[model samples]
Target chain A: MEITSDTHSQHISKQFNHELEELKTHLMAMGGLVEKQVQDAIEALLEGDSRLAERVRDNDKVVNDMQIKIDEECTRVLARRQPAASDLRLVLAVIRATSDLERIGDEASKIARNALSLVEAGRSPRGFVEVRHISEHVRKMVRDALTAFARFDTQLALSVVREDESVDSEYTTAMRSLMTFMMEDPRSISSILSVMWILRALERIGDHADNLAEYVIYLVKGLDIRHTDPDQLDDEAIQGKS
Target chain B: MEITSDTHSQHISKQFNHELEELKTHLMAMGGLVEKQVQDAIEALLEGDSRLAERVRDNDKVVNDMQIKIDEECTRVLARRQPAASDLRLVLAVIRATSDLERIGDEASKIARNALSLVEAGRSPRGFVEVRHISEHVRKMVRDALTAFARFDTQLALSVVREDESVDSEYTTAMRSLMTFMMEDPRSISSILSVMWILRALERIGDHADNLAEYVIYLVKGLDIRHTDPDQLDDEAIQGKS
Candidate 1:
């Protein structure tokens, strides 16, 4: 009887582990979709492809579905497994990461909307090269953040956090240049505002990526580093863990 | 011996219930603090009070602390109790709500930072009256969302979700006006850009608040209303709950 019971319990534990692994896989899948969404949204804007922008908008439904499925899977695991400590932390971190990913999807949708508007209104003064630069950095941040979360790599996560400042600077610079361009040619105000909105969306995507990296660090090191100075994160992260 | 065992179990269950209640009360407290932070941040911008803006920046630490405390309490409860079903839902909802609340604080800080920049740059056009209108709507949405969550009122939550569209419209209108104003007068571009960022922050605050309301609906009804049509939320929420 004892041997049978031990084997039964082992089976249950294996099931639980399998479910958790499934949850992580789903999250990573969702992350991949989000990255593609961001890339496509930027391309739609740069090329003034309203049809491509509409495609990005439509793809958002898929991203939102992934978020809903991942969340349900998480709650199911929590309800069934009753996981503690690191397992519980991992589940919560996934939930936090999903929120960021969903928001990133929303940002992508916003960018796509602006792209459609710019296309309809007629694009003017075609130079948002700085926004393109920022988009490159933003994409890297999201990719690094998802990788860090997947591998439990605190160092990669911290580097993602550090990249946020550069993205932010890029945003500021882009805004300044755009403002001057709009002022220099009033005819471009409508279209330029659309570009500004798209740039804002990209900058926001970077911020959400940074937040995801922080969640990764929190999951790996058991440190709540959301509002901490990026410079101080390495020290605090090392000092805190259970 | 059986009698004592039953009594002891009942006592422990009551203690768990009490702890859950305390967690809720603490969440309400945090909600109140976030609402005040949003208000103060907007006030700083509208009044051009650098001192008030500085105070809002300083108070963000308190907001961050509340989020950490609430999150720690949530993780502890989940680990200790292994709550299932609605009990599990409540804890996860609180965790999600805390993140939105914390982000509201971050947006508030961003608003304050922009307020300071605008103040230092010597106030753009003095009439951010449209931004004031948007701020009023955002504040209402936050207050209503928290109340909806606290009371488990799906009707209120649905309304908050619907209100988001109006906020989005207001943001678009404000942007158009700001862009036209910036183009009409080149010298004011720098200061007006600050106001534009502040408006964007407020618009984002409304979005986060709408998300919080959806989480409340999810918790109360066990249906994820996120990414759903706001028009459809009322019916779906009513149909799905206990």
Candidate 2:
């Protein structure tokens, strides 16, 4: 009446696969929440809506919960299945990705807070249009980074890295304009500072997007491109394209 | 002469222990390198030394290499040993910590680059002294976070999270000051923007420190305090203290 060794092995393998798939599903779920937070934070900035800002803050809790849940699940799998090699890499990557996504959520929350403060301070002066430009640039970078992650597209991920330079340039311009504004009128300094916070938050978001892209590169190519000559990444991508 | 079952079991256990120790040692080595990078990056900013900036930039390669090597070692151990339970958590934590350390290195590199750019722009205006305050605060946070990580002091880690608010405040002040300066004189905008870049980098360093602290908390308590109520962490720490 006892189960055969073959049957037991098959059952264990099935359970392991199910757990691994669940881990991926949970990570993707967390990614969805983080992506939504980023979108809403930017939308709040553009619309000057404190309500949306509140919503982003509220959702951070859910994202945090998912992170913990996913971590526990991964650890449980590691203990139960003791997966090796490629499976181990996937598990490790998920753990790292969860942290990155959680930080992305934090950045979004910061942006929301900044947006609320900006609305309270009133609209920025004329030259502050640069803030909008930076925001749009960063938002696009984040969007593309997430897209690259979802599709496992290293090319798109590399493009996100390349675009980081543009975001940096925009952030530089915005800072200069804001600095000039602060010096011109100390009276509006507080309000102007609020706008700067929003801009800074957007910049951080761009950085997080870059982190996500780096993960995509690691996931797809098993390459540690973190400190490499970004030019090398581009060259490799170019070769692949041809 | 065939080895007995008892002998084989003891050999395997000994091998597992050795691999676990090696993983820990490698993680610490990587941690040390990343911590140095963060310190050097801050020093570069404070001293306005482009040479130091270049060194930090180059050292990122070393950090990246360590990450890949440590990751590979962890994978090898996982594959060969099939570690379970606490051992599994330790391996996974090392993998996660390596990633956080790599990012901490990146943030430091960014600070160095900002310093280099600031130097290129000539001396910052006298009013930009607030950057010094931010620099000191961020440096302290990074140091404390790394210390907490090394000691596995959850209390210190939680304190790092609490201290982030002060850094956030300093960043806000710096942003407002920069914005006012930009509004006053468009001519000084570019130089002031460079200053803001430095501030932004420092703020991000503080953020990374907070992240390290979060990881430390996870490592010690096996609880994910991220995105949860800060009060929850505080209460837990207080209980631990009592």
Candidate 3:
């Protein structure tokens, strides 16, 4: 909710400030919606709630619509206000962030679809524990990434980038165990593959969350730290402001 | 290479036109690099050529660098020229296409990594046919999508969009057979899962190609046809130009 107004409040025209604030507000709403979609997706899978999963799948359109609207708004602001420096970065960040959020919504929908498939296939207990664990980790990462965007907190954004590494390792561990589980019980192959897809979706959601955090860093610090090592990110981000 | 200069050449300022043209050229180069990355990754997987796979992985950094540079150029154009209407859409489309191209690079790198794993584990021969088939299909999709972008031909773009559906179904068919192959011989589970990941990456490359084509439609006709059915896309695209 902060919207980085403390730093960006010096625009000469009230209209420009208002437009930027409105863009932030819309972005936050989109972020929150996708966050909930990710949550509901995991819950539906964990509890076998087909109804909730169906709703998650259906809501993807809503997320898609928000992305298109937000992108158009960004284009309009660029054309109208011609904001330079940090303002340009803000618009660019929003454009990139919305794309990531939409993909998160997509991954959530994938999870929901796999959840429905699992309902028909009957539950297998082998990989659900890993699913629950990784989902919770990624949900927090998504939440924190949005919070970083809202506050323009580079430190929080950096944390999310670091957290993605752990989530990835967790995914790999889960994947190995699931493969072994399927190998041990070949009859569970069909059901376990569904679970593997769900885990893959979750891992990808975490990657998207990582991307959102990187956008926040770029917006706040003027650094393009993508494809850089996470260990070096903190130093590079700090130097970026200088 | 065409760069869509036919329509956009009417700009008043030659410098602005040059900048836009440069952005397009950079985008095409990036597109070409990632397209080759996909092809080489597939070839490495099929041939079990570890050196080629390694080259594919290393070239991902070059792809990443191109994306960042192109994005910087886009932000520079938006700030300096403040291009409106079709020109603005061109910059926006380039920004988006670069992102997709970057991810396609990532997917190609993933395929390469899996290819290395397959080489280490020794080829299983079970899933190679599907891998080759889907990779050829998606490689063409990527090539055609880039060509559509370069030519600004909505018809070619639509064809790429339609081709993605077939690639997706082919993926599902491959996935089913691979799963059955694993259930038949649990000893092959590990290698088969690597192939599955490779297939998943290929399917995702097709999706990115679909996105690139959608951007062309958006760039040419100003239609936001994402999430719309492909069957109706042509009508909507034709009507969008009206």
Candidate 4:
């Protein structure tokens, strides 16, 4: 009797561990898919590849389906497991993070659509160089933010948040350059508007990355640092590094 | 004994009905608060009232707190009552709607902050006329979308979705006009950039209103119309006088 009871307990424990691992795996898979969407969207813009743009639009379905699946799974876990404390927080954070990821997908799709249209309009203006600079910076921020998320590196996430200011500055310069193109020729207004839309999409992608980084901080420290100064975060590791 | 049992069943039913009513009332209250935030945010832009903008920002805390409370209430009801079918759908819809409402509150707060900055910077280069035009259209969309939500008027919601195109077109025009100003005088770039940001926020608000309208359609029809052509929805209600 004792031997049988022990075996049953072992089986139950294994089941519980499996469930946790499965949830984690699902979240990471969803993250991987969303990261690819963002990366490919950027590549499409850089290469002016309309086929890649169409792929981005088509892949949005997969991203959205993943969001719904993850959400349902989280709900099921919450309802069945009655998780408390850290487990509960993890589930809640996943819910919010998945939402941010889905939104990032939406923004990427917008960027791809904008890129497709811009490329179709033939050659862009001479000042498109400034947009390229802004896009590069924003892309870097997005990549680092996702990397920080995958590794749960709050310090790296904080740095990504700080880099947003530079992206904003670059965006400002691009806007001025685009504006100059518009004012010089009314005929250029249509083309300039397309570039402006693309810049707006890139800036928003950066904003969403900052949001993801904020979620990372919340998950690690159990603090809602949104709308608060990042300097307030006590980074012992960073202090030691300095 | 039979009479006593019958009375006991009646009392239980009364209690259940009361709880359901309470849940509905709380959800509606949350909606009201969110709708007010959107209205005030746009009003702040139209009137250039920094005080109103500040109020919108401050009130976001209430909206966020209400979200947490409503979420807890939803889960508690689900656990205690085991609602199914339409009741289940209603609860789920309320949960999703509250989330959208809270996000709308966030968007409004963002708009208000942008407006405050614009006011502090003196006059915007896009001119008050264009700002007013965009603000009025978006506000109307928000009001109509919320009305449709409250009434479950799919017809009205579909119209609101149609109106989003007009808002998008207006945004495109605004971008082109701002680009012209920037190209004409590089010095006006900063002011024009701020104006474009404000317009972008307004455009986003309109997009959210469209999202809310889509939710209304989903709640009423159990159809996911997102990313699909609105014209494809052949329901008589969605077709509505078109």
Candidate 5:
């Protein structure tokens, strides 16, 4: 249950440690807001709540502002604290994670927009099953990615990475079925395409979550495992390849 | 065509300036590689050259490697040099731009994959015109965004941002037509769907380019212009509203 090294706590200045903690707290707040955005956007789509979808669309600005705010704070920390080693990585990781979180928010808004179109069309496509399934899957991945980040848990982060592969496969399966459905019923192509887009958004949300998890691994282990073979990632990264 | 401020050159230590210059060069190299990747991927899709598409897919690793390398250098610069103000912005911009460029590379690879699929399917569908048009448009935007970074030209960067809006509208128009085309000729549905994906990929490439341009503006003006209203971005950003 011991956190790895507790490096942040080892800083000589309590004020410096407090600043890093505050930076992370802000990042976690951003993560929380983005997660709610994704959840609300998906709920609006499934429940045909156009009103909720509109709110999700509007709330994307808040996520954007958070990214700007956190990035400014990171620059300030780097300028003032001149943090080295693990502290530096923590700031860099927050920068990268916020970027991913902001993109996740953008995708959530895109999903909400598609949901609005689908609602106005007033025809629920047959792929809501896939939508619901994948949304829940990716939302968990996002939540877990954040948790891994909060705890500096490489195991949980790796699990998020592994889950992304399954999410990709699920996306493929959903795409194939939807394509078949469209070819079977040409009249459904328009609405089905909108569903396809929403599915695509969810799949991308999963990807952003995957990126967040990778940042966690990078922060904890100092290994930039991005674009590495996922098969080799587990043994090497967790076992301290670097 | 004087570059703005020449703040990077103002650093007192010649060695530090050299390091910053070297980082910029590596980033430009990565930028050039990604631009070619997009260009080649679109050519493969248009000409049915699976060989070229395969090369583009494999070469994404170089782009990935460049991101990690550049990032490490940035971290070192931040940790060792503890660069403040404009020198700091230059490093941060390189970091952010590399991430955008890497994603742009990923999208190019996806386009190449879809290109391979389109070639194997043996049906070119009816959307090649739009493909050629949009690909050329976005390739120029990518080039301009990189040029903006190299020259510290916010004006060029803003132009790239404006071009993205047109590219997006072009994509929307193409999507509508392709949707209609599929509806009219159900037999073309499968090949046309692949074309749709390629178009989608191209649209996303433009988005990444837009992001790169935004980073340039941020580096030069210290303005976080992301998620801003595009219409107002010109007056506020260019007029030195930080």
Candidate 6:
């Protein structure tokens, strides 16, 4: 029934794709908000700004609303258009990427809550400067992942996927240092645990960003590259391109 | 074009719905696997079963495959049938629920890894019995969430959502105790931190379960109750029913 050749049919098809495009725009908007929230949530902790943390926390509802609206739009389009192959992949990718972005928003909220906890505990948390050092890598990973997804650049997506490993190693290093610090200084154990939790949240943000990049590869190549090692991904990329 | 009363059209529609039913059956099967993984992962921690922990970690690939396959089926159905309204809701819910299930699997893997870390750390890790008590509530929440989703029982979904609050309170209590224990005896800090991470994973599993129940409400009534407070959900659920 969708295999029509009429001019009217062609016009309708174009609008259908335009709807997919609109869906992407909404996804990017949501991505943009999540990106800002992550940045501010980390900064609020590193700088110990409860006021800024409160802002990040309150903006969570906006991100949640955008997620609902974007989901509704995706559902509407799937019902009306019934797109095939690549277009179908793109719509599915958008639905998934939106969920990842919303989760990124949730992680940001967690970071802010941890920040407020440290601030209200009436002492500046130790090793927050160290936490910032660790968070920078995750922040860049998130930014680059969003860029790759928007551009559909498999190369960039691949790079983001690879970056996740280094970020994960950095997480291990951070956790080790936190654990050591906790033992050596019992006076600061509570605050150190808070810092550890914040870093854990950042590490997870990197993970969600990594998952987002995988969706980009899946969108482009129509292959499941998840659970595959980054070293293997390089070979898979060559094969996919060839 | 789908708006037809002809016999052939009715037959095609029936086939489409059969596809949806098939998708549901697959989802339930995947849910069953994930549930077992969660149970085994926690037991690996509680009982210090390194062998079981490794098994849970290794089985992650199976869960990942199920998630990808289910997602592909949803995309195919959307591209072919373009189901509207309730049917559209059903497919979208399946896709979303599959992701949650996959995440639950990932968290299970994380828990398993934490268990191995404790086992390798060569310490039995105190406070684990307490951690088991906390995880019990989460495990039940997950079991009931899947039950509610597969049965399309909104009442059960509401209870799952309400149960999350108690699980959350237990998480807080457990965390506070863990922190106190860590500070009092720094010798066990390393193993204790791993236990804390496992407990954190359980709390998140509870959250994912809560999200699953929300999807049921979304599928049944087209209402987004994600950001709403549970106390208010009671009133909202009554309104949604009428």
Q: Taking the tens digit of each residue's C-alpha lDDT, what string does model 4 give over A62-176?
A: 9888877777776666655655545555666676677777887888888788778877887555455766776677767767776776676888888988888778888878777
CAPRI quality band, candidate 2: acceptable
Q: Model 6: chain B TM-score vs. truth?
A: 0.94
- For model 3, the TM-score of its B chain against the native B chain is 0.93
**Model 3: how far is A191 from its true place, Å?**
1.0
Off by over 4 Å in 1: A124-127, A235-242, B124-127, B234-242
Q: Please give the range of 10 consecutive residues that has the lowest summed lDDT in model 5 chain A.
A: A1-10
Find the candidate with the highest DockQ and give its number.
Answer: 3
- For candidate 3, the per-residue lDDT at B87 reads 96
Q: Please report the TM-score between candidate 6 and the true structure.
A: 0.94
- Model 3 preserves the real interface contacts to a fraction of 0.79
User: At residue B130, what lDDT does model 2 achieve?
Assistant: 83
Residue-level lDDT tens digits of model 1 in B101-157: 988998899889998988888764733898789999999999999999889888888
Q: In order, what DockQ does each candidate have?
A: 0.68, 0.42, 0.73, 0.18, 0.72, 0.71
- Over B52-79, each residue of candidate 3 has an lDDT whose tens digit, in order, gives 9999999999999999999989988988
Task: Answer with 4 or 6, whichever has the higher TM-score.
Answer: 6
Candidate with more favorable, higher TM-score: 1 or 4 = 1
- State residue B120's C-alpha deviation in candidate 5, in Å: 0.7
**Interface Cα RMSD in Å, per prediction:** 1.7, 4.1, 0.9, 5.4, 0.7, 1.4
The deviation in Å at residue A231 for candidate 4 is 2.9
In candidate 2, stretches whose alpha carbon ends up further than 4 angstroms from where it belongs are A1-4, A124-193, A234-242, B1-4, B124-144, B151-196, B234-242
Q: What is the lDDT of residue A141 in candidate 6?
A: 84
Tens digits of per-residue lDDT, candidate 6, B43-155, equal: 88878899999999999999999998998898888878878888888998999999999999999999999999998888886777777787788888888998988888888
Ranking of all candidate structures by their DockQ, best first: 3, 5, 6, 1, 2, 4
Looking at model 2, residue B157 earns an lDDT score of: 83
Residue-level lDDT tens digits of model 4 in B29-95: 8877877887788788777899999999899999988876786676566666655545554555666
TM-score, cand. 1 vs. native:
0.94
- Candidate 6 displacement at residue A138 in angstroms: 1.4
Pairing residues by index, what is the TM-score of model 5? 0.94
What are the candidates' C-alpha RMSDs? 2.2, 4.2, 5.4, 5.5, 5.6, 2.9
lDDT of 3 by residue, A1-242 (tens): 36667546554467798899999999999999999999999999999999999999999999999999999899889888888899999999999999999999999999999999998787745889999999999999999999999998888888899999999999999999998888899999888988999999999999999999999889877788888889876655453553
